[model samples]
Target chain A: MTQRISKYQRLKMMNPILQFFRFIYLSIKILIVVAGGHGGTRNIKSSTSSS
Target chain B: MAKIVVLGAGISGHVAASHLRRKLPKEHQVMVVSPNSNYQWIPSNIWVGIGRMKSKQILFPLAPLYKKKHIGFKQAKAVTFHPEGDVTENKPYVLVEGVVGDSKGKQEKVTYDYLINATGPKLNFEATEGLIPGTNSTYSVCTYTHADHAWEGLSALIADMKKGKKAKILIGTGHAKATCQGAAFEYILNVEQELRRHKVRDMAEVTWISNEYQLGDFGMDGMLLSYGDMTMKSHEMVEMIFEDRDIKWILGAGVQKIENGIAHYENLDGEKKSETYDFAMLIPSFSGHGFKAFDKNNKDITDKLFKGFMIVDANYSPKPYEEWSVQDWPETYQNPSYKNIFAPGIAFAPPHSISKPRKSKNGTEIFPAPPRTGMPSGITAKLVADNIIDTIKSGKEQLHHKGSMGNMGAACIASAGFGMTSGSGVSITTYPIVPDYEKYPKTQGRQLGKTFGEIGLAGHWLKLALHYAFIYKAKMKPFWWLIPE
Candidate 1:
């Protein structure tokens, strides 16, 4: 008997495409931070940024 | 020209060596001595444990990288430290035994003007009976090899589950004073997620056992994060997740012994009990790498170390938990006895535990010790390297910087699975990692505005990004130094 695949599982199955978009999104976020002089390579500090 | 010798090539040591090589003049020498030739990014070992990633993806040869950076590398284990050199030489030196390559079993002395002890931890599997990997009843995810072994065990269990066999899985810290509960937390979630993905979640009973007094203590006494206009404690947050996932937990547990499939443990109430498991991954407590130190008079200065860790600027005076203060922690990592020596990462002795100390009715201490993970380790390494660079440039010991955990912040992403869209992870950032009561004046001892925690697919994406980004940075690709520690 085949188990029913849920919506979450279906979304997960499309991870390859989601992962590509996520990569582009994160790259832009990194660029923005670097452009704003908050490069990822700077010293550790107490700041918050979302991916 | 002065030479700086870095002991161990783990995260902290590698970071220090890389920075020193980049900043110091070519005339000055920077060298690293470590047992393994391959550097393993330990954070990804959790993924490797579940066979989500291969060991080769996370492990890389260090010799090529060191050669590219023009830094001397030795595949040897530091056996002893001679602060006061022998009669032939008056300079400080360390005796190391080659453990890899053609120099295996050969011992040599490496002299230095300054030393950085970042040997990381010696996983004390022997501290608990039946905890030894390969020969033991339980498994570990502490190292690449250990994770491989764990994956084998997990695969076998999953195969049985596919055959309609029910199995009990126990995952957590193996010792009473163990740290790195976060790794165990990550592993358990990954395991649970993997079981679900295999369509066998109902056939497995997953349980968590730890020395944490409460869930999500995470060895920093837990932090307070604001959620939907209500302040939430870490334990409360963790409990909600555990309850939703139907994962059972035994908190305040000190695992005393393991025999076959049974783990003998003692809880805070002093009650002794046993739990059975068909498959288990228990993280061991860490101790010093066991390098002996001596003074000019030939007297053992090894006593300068507490429980195998080199004592630094921290106040090591014996005191009760109530009297423990922020001043007790090391602001500067320099050894007071030997000013030229610094111990960063897990090599330095923590003054006291970050979690509130607790004892069982039988006088057994059961509390999570503080953790110095990759972020803090990298930050401290950079600070130590910078201080050393200043001293080298000025030709004077100018210890002008400190990177104490009490004043720093760290970001951690705990991955639950490897799926891009279906994957999930928890991203947590805590400022002033160690609680400062005076600064925050809150019950949780942290700034609520600065502490944050979130769980979603985004965190998993970030985790994957960091794994690749850090490896690229460590490999010293173009502008690697520009990547933040």
Candidate 2:
């Protein structure tokens, strides 16, 4: 429970692999919203993505 | 004419009774029975707890409203239900006693062709040890009085902090099997806001304790909603905001005990920890008052029923979480045994919990919550009413309520200021409250900007209107049904 990874500083200085995965995740999220619009997009995508 | 006896004159009961009047002709009797003659707008208890609103503003007497509608009204708490014909099979009715303070109530036996047990829930203020007055352990917001008491307690705590004391304020449930994380989340933030306003935030520390696997899981699998290229997971979003406000949290932890100002918690990793709080408000776990009286064929009626809510054609099986899906939910909310008896409100149990419960290998109790709100309760009442009326008209039971938690959206406006001001008020709506994780896998069950980002003066006005609008409709004024369910 001691401090290991604080989302604050590390997010700004991410390793290549971590940065790559983050980009992919953000891209997918953006695509889902564009496909569904704000109202139903995330909810609709959630059903398929399986949260 | 089939007489319908509606139990509990709260939101569900009153709504059921009022709709029963419109659906059932003048020939049929629609009777409402409950201990409180007043209908309390429950959600506002938060304001009442914080001294923002008086109890009278939230409470409206139910007797006179029912009388004006020509509906039968009696103020009494229903203690028991004897469904069988008994030894002689002479008169079939349930015998109920009276609440001590209700003057119009007495020991009576009432028979009904159909009974809607919207008997809401029994507030167990003593659910968690030490969460009661005179115990000096913690505080609660289960009822108007409980909220008021919580407010008074917090005020005293604030005063102590002003006296140059470093104080720790903890809010949230001690039980993993608790729901209503929304309220806990709101209270902690409001307390932080209050502290900052008082210019003594530096001297006060705030923390949240819940049974959720994560901060905003809310018994529904965590949801991630993206707003303008920034994706915020519900749990992550809440935690982030809390951190920004300098509030801390303990997640996936169950309360072991609460003694005086000390709280003992067991974390998800089975690590036990203790924390001392200067003031605390811990929401308790909720359950249907599980009471069952058996029938002749060696059958059980209790497991099949909760409070007075009966499990209908619901696909209720003790399924593990991995196999859970929206298809497993019931489409029609009709009781298989008694077609006439319908339930709406907290009394009716969810087919399963939104958040998964993690029990010990030895099968001891752990996390529990099936998040259903007053909106769903009101909608369920409307749907149940429709089905009953359809049954009456067709002379055959028809399943008209096809809506389930899996299919419905929940809109909640959590008040921050109880007034219009800059940086005050929040209106949030979640689509398909039980997330369809398989569909939008990333966010679990959340739809972003389903109006969460639209928070401000307009939101404040909406909250204010809803407060009065709901109260007006509940009072059974003219054109009530036109006001919407």
Candidate 3:
């Protein structure tokens, strides 16, 4: 079955002006998520069991 | 002096060698042994498959870069693992066979103080009958050459469509347990847009066939994504995209064989079915290279080194799906038996698949294997390099540096179209790639805000920008280390 999407949402996805803002917004959001993942090593108790 | 050897020249191996060479002193040595002479930015292969980019634009020779960086390079493929010294050689070394030039077919024991097995999956196109690429109208995009062939086949089909010959196009997993659904997803979107660009949209029907039980399972059991002001399931987002583009889908399909222009598959219902297509590009199953390892006495000890892929510090106990935990994942990709050896990226076998296992009514297992590509590959490689550097300098065994998919994040930008202004992209950022039910306990075991999805032209821009950025980093350009994995 085909999915239903609001007409407004479809327009917004293609709107150059709105998409530019989305571009800026996504850039900042991704930067935050990616930065949080860096140097993300933690000291876990080494497992003893073998595969 | 210490000599570090890294196998394979893919993202993980290349990243590990680069970091090790940069961080370690000139006195120590860093060498890369790879069958491939060129380092290609794999993520950009999608663009090549759609004819938006060329193979040369995505690859560069590795010899010159290694020479300038003082990192040794060997154009050879590892044949056997000799973790312990043999009768003739007392040091831990790997037997590698040269692939080209005067050393072609020659075997040499490459010694190393520490070894990193980053050899990625072997594209098992043979697993599916009559699925050989460039034959029976089936194609692949797992490599640059494959992508080029796909584009050629597709362009020809597009030409036929423009001449009033209606066509059927199929894309998705070619095997019962294939991964890289995201790559196939990206390619389908690009192919759809390319058809529109060539003004043959109405002349061709595009369909997505996958082993996923539902749309957007993506081999990670899908995600609860925060899309703008709303929270939705990954399947919902994918369905909306496909619906808007008027694409058809076949789920729970285990493609068993391909014959001429027809694909035979068994569904979850155990019913046999077939789909006819004028052209197809399907991702094949990824399997281990079946590498054998031995001890100092030349006794066969392959089991100690491999269980399909290399054994790592993961809890690989046989357990049911509900009993699996993120803790079962590997933190340090070090081989337990040989502490001096490590297998990062796809080289390390996962304890279990992130997605729940499923079986066809006929008792055939069909589900996606875990994916260890792109971001995760780079991160794991860097961590392995850091731990090795620490161990070498401290003059002791060090397992300090660690990261796991259970806690690490990955950003996947699926390009729906290709262009600066008209292009569209679907961006999904998933934190702690493996679901942590105990930590989050809700929202599908992921932090909602961090695990978000967005669709717009910006996503395409980000993907293209990363294409150039990663190529620069791979070339070790000025201050390339400043870029994160």
Candidate 4:
């Protein structure tokens, strides 16, 4: 048997109406994460330095 | 005036070079030596492979951009590292060979006050028997040119399928130790969707083959992610996506060899099997460039400079997988033996595989090597550049700027299909690329909400947005530094 996908999951994926909302929600979520700054270098603690 | 040399102009080297040039004065020269004249936004190659985007749209000539920014550009490949220089050259220099134009085959000793070895992994197609791209019905999407050929093969197959001919398509890792399952995963989905778009979906059977023990190990031990209101394993999410798309999967498969239209593989159970396909897109194993190094006395010091890829200030001691700590990962990406040398991105050797190493019953190793591309490459390169800039300005060595895969995060937007309204994407954001079990033991080494997963058209839009954004950043357009690495 193949992996199961509930009708709700399918509707959430293919339904344009729900996807539009998803698009907005994801945009905000991702923007927050990106703005929160998950990247870039941090100052190394003296103890962590190998030099 | 210090001369900083960056080898390879991929994400890592390009980022390092750009930052160094932007931060340092014109007197302090920033040079990039690479065989590839054009700088490619590699993530978009997935779109190009599926005929959604053209190769030119994803890459631009590095020479013009570098010249405009006052950065020295050389279309050459590094042959050997003379970090301690040679008899005649008292200063540290790298031996390079020209790859194009009238300077082809000419060798030159390019000296540097500081060196950044960002020469990413060499795609080792030879590691697997008969796995050459564009031959034996096999293809690759690791580069723009390779993606072009893959699209040609795929489009032809689509045409054949439209003519009432049945076709079998295979896409995944080509070798037992190949990584980048994420790219192969994205490609398969795009191809499946393309088949549907061509109205020949019923005429072809598409398969997902990989070296991963589970469906979504992704070389990071399969994340535990927050999806909507529920918490789920990455494997479950992948299985749902695959099943919903009617995609067949063969996991724990180590592809050993390829024939004209057949792939020979060994599964985790130690059984040998062959899968036949009309078209295949397989990711080859990634290996070091086999660059040799010499000291001032001309003595071979390859071990001091390289452990497969360039050796950085990371713990390389042999230890059990259980005892592997996040601190084992390197922060500064500086080579211990050569203080002036650094390696970021796939150029530096990882402390160990994020995924637990596994072996088949017959002792054939079958697990994904750690992936160190895209976000990690850019972040690591920027950190390395910042530290070098500090060193140069202070007139002393500095290792202050630091980021490690253990503490850094990566957002992977895997485009499932290509379209404004009809496309799909599976977006995964994992914090601390390497799981820190000690810090967050409850959620399998990563923070739950931060290490989340989402599937929808939104992810596609995000992926497309990043394609343009990164291209803009790479081109160093107005205020490009505003874009985060």
Per-candidate clash tally: 3, 29, 0, 0
The residue-by-residue lDDT of candidate 2 on B155-234, one tens digit each, is 88778888888989988886757778777766776677677776789998788888887776766665665433576666
In angstroms, the error of model 2 at B45 is 0.9
Q: Which stretches of candidate 1 lie over 4 Å from their true place?
A: A1-51, B305-307
Clashing pairs in 1: A40-B484, A41-B483, A41-B484
Question: Which regions of candidate 4 deviate over 4 angstroms?
Answer: A1-3, A6-8, A14-28, A31-51
* Per-residue C-alpha lDDT of model 4 across residues B98-158, encoded as one tens digit per residue: 9999999999999999999999999999999999999999999999999999999999999
User: How high is the TM-score of chain A in each model?
Assistant: 0.41, 0.43, 0.63, 0.60
lDDT per residue for candidate 3 within B66-137, as digits (tens), equals: 999999999999999999979999999999999999999999999999999999998999999998989999
DockQ score of the complex predicted as candidate 3: 0.32
Task: Give Cα-based local distance difference scores for all models.
Answer: 0.82, 0.66, 0.90, 0.90
Q: Candidate 1 — number of clashing residue pairs?
A: 3
Candidate 1, lDDT over the whole model = 0.82
Docking class of 4: acceptable
lDDT of 1 by residue, A1-51 (tens): 123334584465346666456446544543332222211111224321210
Q: Pick the candidate with the highest TM-score.
A: 3
Second chain alone, TM-score for each candidate: 0.98, 0.91, 0.99, 0.99
Which residue segments of model 2 deviate by more than 4 Å?
A1-51, B87-92, B101-106, B125-127, B226-229, B294-300, B304-309, B360-365, B437-458
In model 4, which residue pairs have backbone atoms overlapping below 3 Å?
A: none
